[model samples]
Target chain A: MPSTTATTRRALLRTGAAGALAATVPASPRAQGPARGEPLRVGVMTDLSGPFAGAGSQPLFWGAEVAIELFNERGGVDGRPVQAVTADSQSKADVAINEAERLLGQEGLEVVTGIYSSAHAVPLSGRFEQARKIMWITSAISTAVLKDRNLRYVFRPTVHSDQYGEASVSFIHEHAQSKLGTPPERVRLAAIYEDGPYGTGVAAAIEANAKARNMPLVLKEGYSASAPDLSTLVTKLRRERPDVILHTGYNPDITLFLRQAKAGGLRFKALIGHGAGYAQIDRLTEAFGNDVNYVYNVDPVGTQMLDWSKLGPGVGDLAKVFVERYQAKHRVRDLPAHASMGFNNTWIFLEHVLKPAVRKTGGMSAEALREAALAVDIPVGGTIQGYGVKFAAPGTPMSGQNERAFPVVMQFENARGRVVWPTAIASAPPVLPLPPSSPYAARS
Target chain B: MDPFLLEALVNGVLLGGVFALPVLGLNLVFGVVDVIWLCYAELVMVGMYAVWFLYTQAGWPLPLAFAACLPFVAALGVLLHVLVVRPLLRAPPINQVLATGGVLFVLQGVATLVFSTDFRSLGVEMPPMEVGEVFVSGTKLAAFLAALAGAAALWAFLKFTYVGTAIRAIARDREVMPLMGVDPRRIYLITSAVGGTLAGFAACLLVVQLDVHPFVGLSFGPITFMICVMGGLGNMLGGFLAAFLMGLIVSVGGFWWNTEMSYVVAFVFFIAVMFLRPQGLFAR
Candidate 1:
């Protein structure tokens, strides 16, 4: 192997004859038959170098990359090649703003997606609205982005924070109380959260739900995202003797809570997490191991078990092509939520909207593409995740736009970490009573 | 206002003392060596993970795990000095800063690549012991007491021991220490090792309260540095004072305002203090 090389390309100038510079650059055609749908340019901006990079932003980027690759091969968007340029926001709002401007104003990107932190997404929403560019966010579920400043161009593909809380409450009430036979009143709940926007939002929602349901939230604690210790806080939680512990923290905080809870013999009737950091398969296994039994997380669930063939031809054929190519290239099993979400969305947009629009207009201009996307009808007949995607009317986007296919309340059975939720796409019914020493065991 | 609030505040102060332990070590290095040891946070992160592995993974008792880890921290410190610090000693301050900064990133990258980005907390709840009206957890009180005891031990080590005296003398004047037959390079290595060991010692107490992540090092790194500088560079006691002050700011501020706004308040306080005292609150 070659040794590590530390080469600093701080300053490299383009100098020489104008002819040489022009030679190096690819020649551009001045005019093309009134434009026949060129490569569809999409820009992705998200945190890549800050605190939240490893958590989801990087993984989300991989998801989008997979979608673009699949789209390009099977006859690009409406037979026009799709081009994607991704930029890292560095988790800075100002930087995100600047990059969004460049992507919109300079690159003439028709669609923009991917902002991991809500702090960045809130501002980016305004920019996208101004440019009338469509923005599809997979992560960053700040409800504020959806409300108060709702924009026509902005749409979130993944679950929102409010939906997360509501889904969590419903799942507990449905699964924990009825299925697990957990008594409603005896449900002593505690939330260990990081003192940040994400944690606070979930904690507040949980608190409200717990209160309205007449369940006592015995403990409500917040710690720094990078807090080094949780023994004391966990100890206080133990005293409360909560039957259910709802932790709303990032991956590191969750790991600490899991390890320390086991070490201290602080057993709970059910252990549930808000899927922020605990959703990943490897993270859960590594931090808890056998101890992860009965731990349930409310996160994005993919339709892994659903047979794509049942959804009919176009979508099913696309899925087969994607699965074969992806498996061969990456040598991995079926794509996770981060991969499948984008794949399904891209497939929907290309076949249902982009293709017909390009056929009608004879070109893939911004106006033609927008009209096509706006006229999307049969949202869910696709083989991918059974989502049935469609946009809601303006001023009420949440009511209509949220593809019923993806609601974030999937149960991960210990045998195989498959998403079993929304019943329509679930491979199996929610495990009636979480099995012992398995992930859902404690929650049982 | 309530008992929980009081407990959180007291715990914050005690935890703040533990926070000071490593920051104090950084100050010790800064006071004597005049270079910010950016890798000091990584030392703490590694030390906490060391304790986690020894006690949780290796099935050793907590004390044994801590004791076994101290020498490793010291060895790491010595290695850091020989490889990075010593070579950049005669260079410009910026070079020294950049070199140590590089070490910090190298350690963080190694941690991310090897350990994987996951959260780990000591899962067990510490037993709560009542002291008057306030309820304190066993692990937290232990951390608080350990912080106090460690601080006292550090003070004694710097004040009474011959090697400690030599270190202090070198801090005052590196050139003057040559008369006492001590190599400046050797003294620096010893001081850094001492600082690293102190960080390790602090970590054992830290994990007792929270779990350690590779990135937790970066979290505490800048905050502790801020505490050290705000308290007055090279003043160990001032670092302790500043930590508590910042701790109280976060705790009490969080109590009154929303938790999110508390950080903003702390930064405001820091800026105000900086404006008032140009150099710092207690700069030597």
Candidate 2:
């Protein structure tokens, strides 16, 4: 009986192996080409019901959905329809890891994207790498994820924290000299960042860049993200009297800082913010109104004030269509930068990587998809934000970082955010020393 | 003393005034009810959302919206007490804390669903009033004065009013209050309503200066709890003084060091006080 059971097991193994080969055989057209209308599944894991839900998750999800809609409207990826399977991570890293596993293993998705918090993204990046799946990070800008991890499957197409800090410093240097008549050395800079990964990374970058440029960093401070008050910090800032203040924090802290600063009579020649709360234009405007005006923020360009010519032909029209459809779908007048970048990067991924991979390999397998992403080299002006898509080589400092991605400096002018740096695409020049009529003008 | 330090100290005291209103109710609720009311800060949060909806969304006048918040939140407090707290009154103290914790999550979840977690602010524009070399914000000063006035009015009521005296008697000994012809349940209900009203009042004062989001309460919730603990649970005057003390320490420490260090110093002070005086600074 034992010998008969062994013989049956061997036969079963041989039969299963043969069946697997038969399924993959070139003779089966259904196996080679995606079934006529079968939708390509891409997972979008984000914090839909957590602390970050309003911050970026909702918009990030909408952004990716808009991209998929655009792709499907244009006869998706080699005529194989693309769809997004969304999972709410609830802004928790462990939940994100579980969602990634379920999406990749149970849902059988080849590519996953959309994580708002670095805490969620970093862990998912490792899981994706281990699983040999592709993860396109849209919003998490922490540098630590790509710093030492040489994960080939993980790719970030958006600007990172370091770039934001560099852009902020550069914007102040250029604008201070040109607008405020203060040179780099003569400028007094202070940095106040939330004591978190995102804030610390950006602050470190700002410090490094300031030192490189010989700028005097008078004060650098860190605070908790959910601090109830910032009056004391504002008092310290007032005493320091820095010419340029670079701040990085989330929504609540940012709102508190500005309010407390107003109360403390803190003003500067150039008040530059590095993304996060400052990039939330509508929220900032709603909270501060004219007070937010004249403040400069360095971040990814939102759907507004885009130079169409900078992006490749036909991409500009697509962006407009995206904005219109997004507004109609979400019923929001303004499309945030998180949503815009999410839409653009996902569209780029679909166009330059997924579709091509499916067409070339005759199937959407994980290895084939990663190879396509690695070979992706969209020239500058190819995407909606005029950013080129090219993942850096593995094992390098820029490991998964997008080399062509750079932060754009935008100044809030007349209750609108206008690009004010990099010369070529600036909508308006930076406003320096804030006019006396401005609410933020120095009292003295 | 340096003018900068003086201004910081003044601002700290003003902040303490704002801080006292919210924590006073928590202290009151805990003192009398013998329940933690963990969702106390969330009640303040709900009041803030009500003000935002009324003033910003519905175009109601700021004063009218603020006034409306009191009744709305007071009703909510009564509902919470009847539905959630009353049943747990017979349960263990831990059960009451756990029940209120559940209420906290539910309130936050409901708030997130309704408000969409976006930061909403009234954007009340008021110019700064220059006091010599120090600039005081009009909104902060108004909030401070309102909070102080609210506290004083409540104190007066507790001192003079018949209902207020009964409530205080209940706080002193719930068992004895029943023997004194005062119904404990009725007094508890009234105390809950009063606590909710105070939270609403604090919310109105806060909304003028801060943005309102779903988790806005969480930002100050822990600190307010700490203030309650430091002041001695159930000791109103002690909590009041503790609030101001914590505010001044945070302000001065933050000025001398950084904001993070300031909080560190506060926690250190809290631990030292807890070790030396386990019942808290003002525990009777």
Q: Number of the top candidate by DockQ? A: 2
What DockQ does each listed candidate score? 0.19, 0.34
Q: Model 1, B164-268: lDDT tens per residue? A: 998889888877779878777777888988988888887777776654666677666777887887898888888889988887776566555534456678789
| B1-284: candidate 2 lDDT, tens digit per residue | 78788878987898798789988999888888888889988999999999999998899998999999999889888888999999999998888887888788678767876787788989885777777667777888888888889999989989999999998999999987799799999989999999999999989998888788878887889999999999999999999999999999998898888899999999999999899997998887
Highest-scoring model, TM-score: 2
Candidate 1 DockQ, CA atoms: 0.19
Task: Report the error of model 2 at residue B221, Å.
Answer: 0.9
Interface RMSD of 2: 10.8
- Model 2 stretches astray by more than 4 angstroms: A1-36, A91-110, A331-334, A360-365
lDDT of 1 by residue, A1-444 (tens): 001101110001111112322232224432221122476666766655445655555455555555665555555654475556666664457767876887788777777767777767778878777887777666766666766554677766556666666666656665666765766655677877886667767788788887777777888877776654454565466557776677777665666666545544465666667755665544455445555644566665554545766775676666666656555644544344544555555555556656777689876555666666667766554536566656555667453245444455555544235554554555656654445554223442
lDDT of each: 0.65, 0.82
lDDT of 2 by residue, A67-142 (tens): 8766765667766777667777766677788778888988898889888877777778888889898898888898
CAPRI rating of model 1: incorrect
